[model samples]
Target: MTKLTKRDFIAGATATGAAICMPAIARAQAIVLRWADGQAMNHPSPQSAVKAGLEIKEKTGGRIDIQTFPAGQLGSSRDMVESVASGALTMVTEGAALLGQFVPQISIIEAPYIWRDPAHMTRALKSPLMDELNKVLGEKRGMRVIGVTYYGIRHLTSGSRAINSVEDMKGFKLRVPEVDTFRAMAEAWGAKPTPLNFSELYLALSQGAVDGQENPLPTIQSAKLAEVQKYLVLTGHIITPRLVIVNDAAWSKLTEADRAIVRSAIETASAWQDAEIVSQENSLADTLGKAGMTVLKPDLESFRKPVLATLPAKFESKWGKGLWDRIQGL
Candidate 1:
């Protein structure tokens, strides 16, 4: 055989060293946590999640690794929940409105006028009531809620025209998430609620599949919904909260040390995301105006009255009056 060149020898040595070092590196490294969200990678929620992951690795001295998949690369919010529940996926960031499907008691957050401001909502979340609810979710649903981040204040956007009152929404085809609370709200507003997958919403709007939809300003801006829609009604009917969750199975598998690192990282991310959402909401009116969309500040109380009148009785009977009272106290 020909003599081995110096380059070949060096390459062979490097390969051998890498092979020997890999197991040690892994042993010292943090367990890799996989997370997926429905928003685009650059969106604030996912961006915050990514930053939090980096912080976790740094804080833990590379003892844990976090990998985030954005833009529904895995699937929609519902699919994410199922995957996480089955331990097929590690974690997901989802909206409370969507999570209502699995745990109906959590839907109380989506009630119209439930919170006067973001601070009120934050306080309510930390209450014993919510802590008990978390236990129910963990014990019954097999998921752990790490933390919650605000999405934004919900608003109505339409292709037809401005919605100034309850009457304006009559007979309108409004797109809603596949959740009962949202559908109920749409029906109470006199609009025909059409459940559509979020991925299909843009095309549906552009093709006239639906006349209107509702979401916060950042989502409207990030998704470029203003480009396809004409009128925006600022009703602020709901203050949306995004829940960060992990599969109970996956969470249980982690060492207690690793769990502590994950929790701390998530708390940091929650604070960052909430502040960012507030700033974005404050600036969104100007942003939407520049995008050439007409923004209407509708009579929010008038819109809320109808939904509030009926929802309490309906939900209290199903869940419990005590739960409703606890939420009201908050």
Candidate 2:
């Protein structure tokens, strides 16, 4: 090899410096991501999402800035998923129920009376079952699951009447998110299920378009459903886990380091959201009672067995055989 001259040495040093500065320059001109949520602005779902965005901005050194749109300012819940799937938006929040449409396996987690406690649910989610779901979503739907937040135990509230038993559910029209598991559960327990968007639920309830709707305790409080619906029946049908999703196309554009930062930020925020949910949900029943909504902790036994006896068999194909048993084992 020939000996290097001063000019060559100076040129090599300049190139090295430029390469070192490139990532920082790119960070300064970072991509702006839109993170959408259909829940109300003050709802913990959107609040947690905003925190995630802030964390990403900090952790990524301003390389990825996420902007949040809550309370369906962008559109309906389904609309947000479609937007992210098509890469029109960067992020979205979907409960396991909604995610079922995109990745059918996700719905199994929404099955009623499956988990004994929050710890059980969390363990199942961290197991291979969840790994399979991530694989299915990534491979089939081009969606990435960056975070999982606790959505709390969903209970039924009716504008029609107080339902203490499964027999009370007959001849009722229940508003369900457009998820098959919910529809199936409602039907099995003796109600006509009407699928509706989250943003439209309050109006539907108030207008008599649907007799009732089911949601987590925080959702009831945050959406102020107590204002219209009179009865809260703690059926505890679904303990939902909300997911923070990113468009795979947009995710692929990021550097590995940035992707890791995004994941960590979202996960940290997810934990915070879960804690917030536990805190908020603890007092929600009393709060609803004070809000003039009749809160009933009914004998869920009369309701649970009917659905368990039928819904699982019908839903098994969509959720994969043995999935329910696997979840229980977890």
Per-prediction CA RMSD (Å): 8.3, 10.8
Backbone clash tally (model 1): 3
Extract clashing residue pairs from model 1: 29-63, 30-63, 30-64
lDDT of 2 by residue, 139-239 (tens): 98898888888989999999969888989889899999998888888888889999999889989999999999999999988888998999999888777
Model 2 clash pairs are: none
Considering summed lDDT, which 10 consecutive residues are worst modelled in model 2?
1-10
RMSD of 2: 10.8
lDDT of 1 by residue, 1-330 (tens): 122333543464366446646777554544667788888765799888888898888988886777787777667789888877876668899987677778878877766667888788888888786777688788878997887888889999999677899889999999988888788888889899999988789999999999989988888888899889999888898888888889997799888887888898888888888888889999997889888888898887778889988877877764566877777677
Q: Report every candidate's CA lDDT.
A: 0.81, 0.83
Question: In candidate 1, residue 30 scores what lDDT?
Answer: 45
lDDT of 2 at 224: 83
